[model samples]
Target: MSLAVNASTFDQCLTSIRALPDGTDGIVDNHGNPVNISSNATAISYGLCKEVCGRDSGAFEWSVFSQQFSAWLLPWLALISQLPFGAKHRSDNVMSMLLTVGSPVLGAYSLALTVLNSQWIARRFSGFKYPNVGLAVRALSSLQQVPLEVSAEYGVLASMVVLPENNEWWTELVEGLDYIHTWSISAASSIAWVVIAYLFTVIDSFANVSENIQANGQGVGSVWLWLLPIVIGWLQVSPKCDFDRVAQALEKANRKAYLADYPNPVPLSHKTGRPAFVLQHYRRGSVHRDEESSAPIFNYARFFPWVHAVEQVAEAFERASENALSHVPVGRDVPWAPSDVGVHGDNRKGTLDDVQARPRRGSPIGRWGSDVWTRVIVASALALSLQWGTTGAAFMIVWFTPTKGLGCRSGAYLLYGLISTLVWLIMLLSSIFAHYSHLPHPNSQHLHLRGVVDETAARLSVALRRIGKFVATLNAVWIVVICLFQFSSFFDRCYCDSSVIGLGKRAFYTLLLTEEDIPVLRGAWIGGTLFYYLFDFVRTI
Candidate 1:
């Protein structure tokens, strides 16, 4: 197959494209061929081009040159271009909000959470399944399962490129301060994204991305391990095809019908809704973000990782309750019933699912270091819990919940009360469910000895210990709620700062918060939450 290029067309259009700023991303690594317009109805089309640029860097060089050149014309625009369209000046808007996570020192942490949250939701709701498969294949499938969108990544990076810190205002913004923390945070965030964007663009992360090299389709997932090699190989070559007569053949086609024979239709400024100046972004045309595989669809699902994290925390609390209830001694007249669930599966530890509960033999307790002191500790904890609920007892014996000042947020300790009451009810109900399902009481050999109250207490204990798992399983709603609030930029109502190091006395609910004398509460929350999840994820793996 022959590809065509017209030297005069590129020479004529170079200045117009070079003067473009906003459209730089679409053309960064764009590739397309020269095709003469019929009746001026045809338009210039560009795509993710590789071979036609002579070398990989050639495309990158052209993209950067045009970008730098546009920067030089910061005080200029509305240029006339070869493809016949005037460039409309574009500026920052909500598109810039994708990178709005900057400003707090926790920029990278928030970014990582955003990415992980996006991945977790994609995994949870995905209809696509990886069947019972080989380990290597399953792992690879898992890798592919978590797709990162290049388009989204591109949008974020493009914003960072034009962010305030990268321009002249950066100096004035940092003028008097010996060290500008927020500016530094913004700079760091932009730098990190610059690397991410380069990889996303240069490596071609978009899935099933018009593998025909110069065609159109939609999908976004990638095997960067493989693309890395391809990029490296392409970087070493300068491609030149012997297609001298291809442009001549196209030039001779006067009838538009002849152009329809080609599978790849040329995209003109009119064909695409964008202005010609926007089209001038990449190699005399523009490239578009593909949407396929459901992952790239932007929505609230992107913040789901935090939901998963909170659910896990809730589950942990439930497990603590379960363990405490299990140790409580039965009454004097209540005959001790064995919990050995009539001999279930082999007592293998790691082989069992973390959430799955099996009956345990009630013998040899002292051998495992459960002596008088342990019993005393348990009894004391139960007393305190009965009086003050788990949160207070938890505070007395242990250092209490790691989420500091959580209790202070509510009126008269009402928040902890709400949390405890909810958890207690959840545990009691879940324990009851497990009793019905697992029949925690081993088939009572004393057939007539089954007492209703005794059996009820045993089942309730089991449920209390295991209620956390149920909370986690159905935690989708809470997760979505927290995510909406965490990154929410539109939270107009403000409140007092109950955060660990909240500003003077007030705090906003959303993470994109800025205040003097206090760290961004939401930023720190997101960052800390993300860090906990990272370790948790690692432990899980």
Candidate 2:
């Protein structure tokens, strides 16, 4: 059989493959000359290629598989590349205030919750099972290895990619991503949404401006002018793909490293853990056989040694797998490499003493020793910084503007409250539906406890904990009220005719909200300021 190869290595494996008998479409080099080959040539060819690649048979197979997937990866990436623009441009208006703020909040919340749900599902349903007469084989082959550290890292990386820092590109991407999820479309949808939204909003604004201009023949600067185009351009150019790519690469590297370290690792089962009963039965049977057959004295000792060795092997495998799953320092913080086991000071006694001494006083909830606590702290701080920046801007727009005392207008405030409430309601409903759809049925069974009743109770306990946490953190009612007040418009309306405010809207919402409207715009300012701290509390919990 003919196979493609690099030109430099064309002749390297040819001699070995040329010795087989002739067949239809037989082996040939680039010149297409008939080359004799054997009936079972594929295996030999594969072995030869493996030798050329300097890899084991299995590794070679994996490499080929990765390459094949890589071949198709570009088209897939191209599809993803179209997301922000497809989703954002296709919308009916450019930078809709309702959408700009609502989209990111909804998207960030949903994405965060989805990832949490995935983590919960993976942790809760983890086990091993077998069907029918294949139970023995299943027992030997199926293992439940929980890579807790890896899972935590993956969750952290995912949250970072979804939740970016305060920036224009971030706002566009988040909002764009939210629209994609809300509609469940490809990135191409995002691009289309942006373009469409820009066109319609610009056209509508221009139509109104034209009517005003015609009414008095007043010289009106281009109404929609650069506003819609700038939003469109920002949406189109957002670096969302790079972030996702980096995140995916990290996850893949970590999982690959983990699985490599713990091949077919299984969670310890009660049956597997206690092999004393099996050994006792075997010893009794062996003694009876020896008595009947008059076996040599060495035979019993030999059998015992083999049995003990087997037990040791099983126990060692269990320990290694468990350690890997627990994220006990492997030997490197890098995912693909073994973690540095002794880096945090060997024996863990010193580490424990240091931790106890420090006590981590910033937030009580974040003092947990898990690495997840670090993520919670970092993400919380980031959220806080963004909230403060946005609140500060709103303060300036409302109270410190040069021409107008940033005061709230009644109609605009009403509009702001209405829009915010409506958007939040939709967000809440969508999240509820997403969570509900992912729930396991009520009649689920345990893998290790077919006859045991306590396993069912344990599962229920875990489920209850998860539900309680969700209810407390995802407080839908408070989030709605907070979101309603978060928008600057709720405090003060921007000068309707000022093109500068239109351009600065994203900046205002993101870092510098300066709206001058409503009676309590200043008091509401504190709410925005405190929102991030509260949000962090929710996240850490």
Candidate 3:
């Protein structure tokens, strides 16, 4: 469609058209066909003016201002969001710290993927017909795919080790591998999220560019879309170990040991008329055994491999200290207890009542009051909310936006995005529920509401895990299918005049765009910025 108005008038009409709300239609094409303003804003706007005015208009100018604006803005937002700033406590552990430090590398790798697949870059480099240049581009793009595929493999390993319930062998392997496993899992998780974020960004950017430039071709496709299920599966199967809970358990264990070392018969306190030193063992020997058995073990060796050897040394020192203490004077000089001291039944009963009424040491209520844990929870909630909001927004854009037809590449992306988002939503809800269920609760109280919440959380956890396993298996099959398509040339000849024809052709076309069609630098910029967002989600959640 050609505009027929003068330059000044055309600008005014374009401005007015943009200002009008979506679906407002007075615009028509040269054939007198009504043009929907919302379908393709820029294109329809031009078409509207062309038919309204006669053929004496100055040269028409195409505007890509929206694309330029988003190109500048979105990357910065992704970068800022990816930084390790909000949830500082997450990095206190070794596994998290490794992930944090390796984020930049992952971000760079993602950037490379984005650049290689970018339509904008492809358009610019389409002029280069040299065989050598094409080969170099293909090699670079091929290199970019390797890390992602490797990371996916790592994710599978991590899921197998961490996901199964009551599996002693896997647990032992994880313990034996220790930091090796930690680094591998962290790298896998970071890569999966990074690649996902960048792929999402690339699609969003493509849409923006498409709308801005009025480019009419099949929307981009990617094998990366198949990676979504695997990532979601990884998230579903990964264990949710609350750092705060572990820290509290360790602190409680240390406090118990300290208390255990105190003398059994302690002097009575003057103010409360209670024992100055209350031996937990004296009050409840059986209860102590039960609590110890039930208490969560915070094994340092799982995080820091060196901690195991240190623990052995510490145990030796502890034994020596015990031996020395045992040799020390058994009894200290003190006021002798008279027969009358314990003779009064009322006094003895009052002392027992006071001991019973005393608060249990290291209670859940006290642990929950920690500022660090509170900050961690708030940060996690905010991060998860942001991820859900963004994922929902992307899904809406892809699903609701008007496309050519269901046979087009846009349809494929829409289907992939929809299914992936649904799976992601399930994983997200499971994570949130897991977090809630793991919170410390008062063992003394059996509140109906708490019981209901726990039950609901447990059921959701079980259902999601089952779904995750099924999806993981499906994804494995999907990956094989995608690989067969990538390696085979059978679909190279298949093309639809109206839409993308075969799955192999569509997948091959997307890979080709990454490997040969797009320039290296531009792809890197786009992918890196978008991919960096994975780190933000990984660290915060």
TM-score for all models, in order of appearance: 0.19, 0.23, 0.29
The CA lDDT at 215 in model 2 is 13
Q: Give the per-residue lDDT of model 1 (tens digit) for 209-233.
A: 2221111000000100111211122
Best candidate per lDDT, number? 3
What's the distance in Å from true for residue 144, model 3? 31
- C-alpha lDDT values of all predictions: 0.23, 0.27, 0.29
Candidate 1 wrongly placed segments (more than 4 Å): 1-447, 451-475, 486-490, 496-530, 533-541
lDDT of 1: 0.23
RMSD of each: 33.3, 33.9, 22.4
Model 1: residue 425 alpha-carbon error in angstroms: 11
